[model samples]
Target: MKKPFRKKRQGGFTLLQFALVVLVSSIVSAVALNRFEYYREQAEIAAARQVVASLRTSLQARAAQLLSTGRERELQQLASANPMNLLLWKPENYLGEYYAPDPQQIGGAGWVFDPRDRSLVYLPRNARSFSFGSSKLLRFKVEFVRISNKSLALNQVSG
Candidate 1:
């Protein structure tokens, strides 16, 4: 009668069960970390693309204003501006530093705005030199192009 009344009591979980729990949690965490990294890269790339889009839209708007508002002469001048001077400097170089950064700006990642192609080219300053133009590679290690806008200062401009 006493043996029948006694209940078999089990001690907590086995070692194998604990180990499996830990393994499952670690695998879940690893997968989550990988997902976070992928999304982070995508966000950074999108930010760079927005930079290109803003530049393109601004150039087109300025050109259209100049062409339609009795400022055709100025628009024509910009259209004929030298490519080296335009991308290298700007339509009005003396107005301000518009083509690239002050060269002393933070990161020194000097950029060139190609109004013709609606591209914001990132021309990084080399470690060997402080000048952004020091490397005549004529290629950007990273560049983004905007496809929606037309070239600025065109012969005919429309909204």
Candidate 2:
């Protein structure tokens, strides 16, 4: 007698196929994570640049006001003062004035004015890829600079 025909078996992925899929998935995940971290660092740097630009503009405006009021001598004082004070609104990342800020205490990407050093410091959250030379913190100081024979300007000097 002839035997009856049967359909072929259909099942889920085999062990080898499953392992390959997992390996590819993990590789993609790792690459995506690294890219995300890189973008985050770039964003932090851009935000810092924007804040610095705003600060320079505010410093110039304050200096101009003082000059108009005939207080040019007082312009020198701006060099040591907290530049954040000149802004109408302080950035949310600003941690206010600190005499000697401890990096461990500040803990993340933000701004702090060190009264002792008379410098504005920026702490990066993603500092691993950034090259800050000997120090990880970026510091800036405001100073009056003579640009021309009859012109004076308030400028931000990186420290």
**What is each predicted model's overall lDDT from 0 to 1?**
0.45, 0.78
lDDT of 1 by residue, 97-151 (tens): 2443333544444344445443234433343322224443122211212355323
Model 2 is weakest, by summed lDDT over 10 consecutive residues, at 149-158
In model 2, which runs have C-alpha deviations exceeding 4 angstroms? 1-8, 149-159
Q: For model 1, which pairs clash?
A: none
List the candidates' TM-scores in order: 0.46, 0.85
Residue 83 of model 1 has an lDDT of: 24
Task: Report clash pairs, candidate 2.
Answer: none
Window of ten residues with lowest summed lDDT in model 1? 136-145
lDDT of 2 by residue, 26-143 (tens): 9999999999988988888888889989888888787788888888777778767888898889988998777777768877568999899788888777556663566667888875
lDDT of 2 at 40: 84
Q: What overall lDDT, based on C-alpha atoms, would model 2 receive against the true structure?
A: 0.78
